[model samples]
Target: MSKKTVELSFPKLVLIIATTVFSFTSMSNAFYLMSYAAMPWYIVAGLLFFVPYALIVSEFTGNLGQYSGGLYSWIDHSLSQKAAFLTTFLWYSSYTIWLASLFMKLWIPLSILSFGQDLTTRTASFWHIPQIYWLGLGSCILVLIVVFLINKGFFTISRFMLLGGSLIALLFVVMAVSNLILLVNHHGQLSQPMQQHILLNSPNRDYQGLLGNLGFFIFGITAFGGLDTVASLVDRVGHNKRRFPFAILIAAILITVTYLAGIFLWGASANWAAIFTNQKVSLGNAMYFLMFNLGHQLGGVLGLSSAGTLILSQIFLRLTGLVLFWAYIGLIMTIAYAPLKSIITGTPKNFWPHFLTKENKQGIASHAVLGQGLLIIGLIWLVVFSNAHAVNLYNNLTLMTNVSRSIPYLIVAIAFIQFRKQQHDYQLIAPRYANLASGLVITTILSAISFSIILPLFKAHYLESMLLLIGPMIFSIIAVILYHHFNRQIELS
Candidate 1:
């Protein structure tokens, strides 16, 4: 450690890590989980999956903080390089699924901005073909443009991310204040009153079963999935050995509280009965719909005319759309190349095609980005065109995303246990009991994955459940294929 090396203060590290966790999380997850498991499942998942995973990541911070490749660097050092590649491959693939899904979801906000409500179903198709396929094709074209324009980069993205972060903060604050007012003005009456029994059980009858909507609980866990992104920043923290891990632990707890509060605050305005009875609110447009209702109800609480309330609702809806569109456009581009770059640069040059590995003065690998973008477009076509219904496609994509994202954590958790044992001593957490913290997290995630797979079968979503089980198998097969291909290339070279 050099005295000249600049280091972040504890408070600054907390702020940075908190922002990272929040960036990884989503208000939409709160609404999705609220529809089923609500707060109880949130608490359970937070303790078992969320916090312990943070502990595992924090353990990585002190050891692998010097490396910038995040999970790839950490796992490569602690485990085999091939093991690292496989872990990051799963992570990148999960995120790519999310990227492909966003093409369809971006329509939700576009619909809200154009009309007063979601019109995704109408816009999903034109000339008897899904528009998402067209957008996916367009996305591939844009990636080629990006490949050509990589050096002169289109525009700086920091400003977009800053603006997006601000909008998210404001969105939560506005919701919290409006819901708080409603709670008081309504004389301590909740629109959806919480009963002890209902809080612990699945609230939506459609999702109720012995396993109790395990998918949503896993969805809640997915919100905690991006600790690796935060792990990348440990190098900047002042006391890398101590402060960074503590900051992550603190950020994890704070994020859990925020999500739990957001879920609870929603009940002040959104009645579960009304939303459930009206089966129209699928997972697709639920957030926009709920936020629109929040604005409308808040306008009513302010003693506005029906017309004024409608106008306010429309304004709010459009604003949500604009912000989401702005945020995700930049975010998608960021994730698209960022993860690919990490994976490509972290490994030996022969592991990828030379053209793909070749970087110009701009530090851009054009072919690799194009290759990934082409793959994403293909996946988008398969998912968007395969689903018969717009809502069902979005639901499948979102759930598939949950399963995709969850596997990375399972890989890391199991790896972290091994990573920590090689350490002479543990810092903030003990490694004895075979690193029990990660063990608990690993068990919880595997259970969620297992139950999420088998339970949905009884409900007759046979294909969806089947995918949840086989999704990892598919990813693992791809990882194996890539590994062998690269290994053969190395041998020949």
Candidate 2:
């Protein structure tokens, strides 16, 4: 008799892929980035970009069935090899810069955990240097550890993603409850409708400010992607056609709700100006502070001793800090592994040089891992040592990462259009014209938004802006040049 098939349930599949795709931390950060103004944009982007993008991916994955390299595979099959290389390069670089941002963010939880501060301090001593420097140092250590683990073949991406995703889900619940307590304390009620706070009063209509918000909008869009990372595992799901779409739809809804909750809770006590005061605190750090205070409040309410409140809050805060740090490591690990594997595995042999093609005994891409790690380390150093203020530097990196990351999505849309055009035998999931039209419209809108955001950098930020705009393109160009050169050499030899 044939062995009974074992399949992952829809819920289990969602757990595996959710963290690798959407991050609550990023969604919450974007919530605070645009303050209440993010609400309308979220709705707008959700309809115009997010939902359509997900549909496009689902259609592509369904049609491509059992052939998976995620984005790289999708593009490579539909477009020229050079286009595939460039798309994958931009995709990979997006996460790499994002890794730098996360590295710098390590100090946030550390300062909160060790020093009990809401605002990240630049002055505290760690090995005789500033506290921020230690954070940078810690980031370097994390990169080294990740490289070592991947090279040693001890690393697993989905396990970390599942663990981290589960904790983030728990964190959301904790945050909601704690924020409720704080809300009751301040407002004398817990039943106030959150929708009232959704629309900002006198929203900023200026071009430059709106342009900056475009970056945050793009960040929100990024929170919805990378779901296709789990395409290879689609067949393992019990019902791919029914389950996968339901899972992603539910994930999108949950993310949207969480963003609203966070924005309303925080905005209940502070104006947009106050919320935007420091890019350093971040939504996660703010949640820590709320948790700390809520611990004390709950202890008193529960009739625990005064000392118990202090101890409980301290313990809770420390635990939160540790969990957050570990989650960052998990996320960066997945980021480091996923795109690199996708790009290399999907590309032709001659496209990448032998050095990058080398793998360890366990099939881990050792050389590629090292190269990615070194790039991240250099990026961290540049940001940490830059003359720009920490907040500006971090924000700029985020915007750059958002821009780079969205490029692949745009390419994916274009590729879908091309694929549908070339394959007349393909059954229509939706109408081909509707799909193609929406994809083009979404890509064009996103491009316009990105261009508007990058335009002012030429005048205001000058050099930093230039790097942010040109850096990924330059890297992609270099990759293309090397690919051609290698092909030429092979032909001669």
Candidate 3:
């Protein structure tokens, strides 16, 4: 008997939206913003900054569809191949850093659990054993295995990521509301004045410094960097033109509201000093502390659930990171090989050319996969061996990832401006709103200003920071030189 055949449809566009937003919002940076910056100011800034960027991205995505490589395609079509390559290269580079940072976060909790409270003591038993290093190494190995499994086709992993994200979100809301309820019922008042002057004073007193005390608002904006991931998956989305915009709007509102709730509760429950001094810098930790205190009133079960949720959320985060890393590797392999395959086998560009263009093994060039795989392995190795400076390394990596992701946004802004001017006959299906052009202008200006502001924040000793900024530029230059060199060699051949 012949085996039954089945076709698989691409996942719904809404799922893509949910996953993308979840990925960005769950970053530890978002939590940092709530603890450090002005909560109300952040809410306002998020609306001002993210909304336009979202609209621009949605429109560009709607116009381009799956044929273009989404962001890479938009840049390539609007600018040059070199620019396109740089955009994609930067994007991939940023995700590499993101993967490393997430692994680091997961390792932190594991280390605490393994080493107990003495984990912080430099001369403790755990320190003598260097348990954190071993834990981090083990985590890396686990991640590698997970990535391998994902590559072998674990489609359900995406759904699991979404589910985990939802659970995490629910935990955040519950903890936030619980803290607020407790504060209100106990007649808790702000420990210090909530006035502007009180918030502005810093113990360090470096008021005029270049790194001038970035508040929660700035951090919130920075944390929003990963939202563009949704736009990247536009091609894989169903009803992209209709549903994508709504998804973006909904996600932005949910994230903003969640952040605001956390900040208000934190303010009510703890003073600025307590918030700053808390060693549990992670969002999960803050929520756990709040819930544990509030749970004493509601019985122990709620507190236990909160702790359980945080632990489960970490597992989900690790799994999601692994899946994303492998998916990116797969994408890069496909992109690198498609041209080479066309050249080597002389495959013509026509409809239904060959199975090589359809199936994963056949379509994806092996050499490209090997190259990227080696890079990933090397990065994991660096993370493991550099344990002494791991905290600094992770922070630098996070900043770099943020900067690199911003590059595509900048390029897209330029592209949108150009398309509006040159393509007069091209109709914009969605009518432009009032101040839309102004919004684009402001985004472009802010993009430029923010890059300038953040570049110097990287200290010189942080090699990862230097590499994150310089690596892509170097790769671009090398590509150009090779292109010319190869052309000459071909002439000589």
For candidate 2, the TM-score is 0.78
lDDT string for model 1 (414-444, tens) is 8877776675444667547446777888898
lDDT, residue 113, model 2: 70
User: Whose TM-score is greatest here?
Assistant: 1
Model 1 spans with C-alpha error above 4 angstroms: 1-37, 123-159, 229-247, 381-404, 424-426, 460-462
- Backbone clash total for model 1 is 0
User: Tens digits of per-residue lDDT for model 2 on 1-493?
Assistant: 0011125566756665555565655555554455566667667666777666666666666665444355777787788877877888787777777877777776666666776664564467856777666667778888888888756542255456567777776766676666566566666443223445435432333312645556555555655666655553343343553466556666656655666666666543344454345555555665565456557766665577989889877876776776676677667666777677777766766556778877667566688889889988988777666657855766665655555666677778788777776653334355645466456546654665456457657459676566657665666787688668867876776
Q: Report how far residue 137 has shifted in candidate 2, in Å.
A: 4.1
Error of 2 at 436 (Å): 5.4
Instruction: Give TM-scores for every candidate, taking all chains together and pairing residue i with residue i.
Output: 0.83, 0.78, 0.68
Candidate 1 vs 3: which has more lDDT? 1
Q: What ranges in model 3 sit over 4 Å off?
A: 1-19, 22-37, 110-133, 187-218, 239-242, 278-371, 386-402, 421-472, 478-493
Task: Give lDDT per model, in order.
Answer: 0.67, 0.63, 0.48
True-structure lDDT of candidate 2: 0.63
How do these models rank on TM-score, best leading? 1, 2, 3
Backbone clash pairs for candidate 2 read none
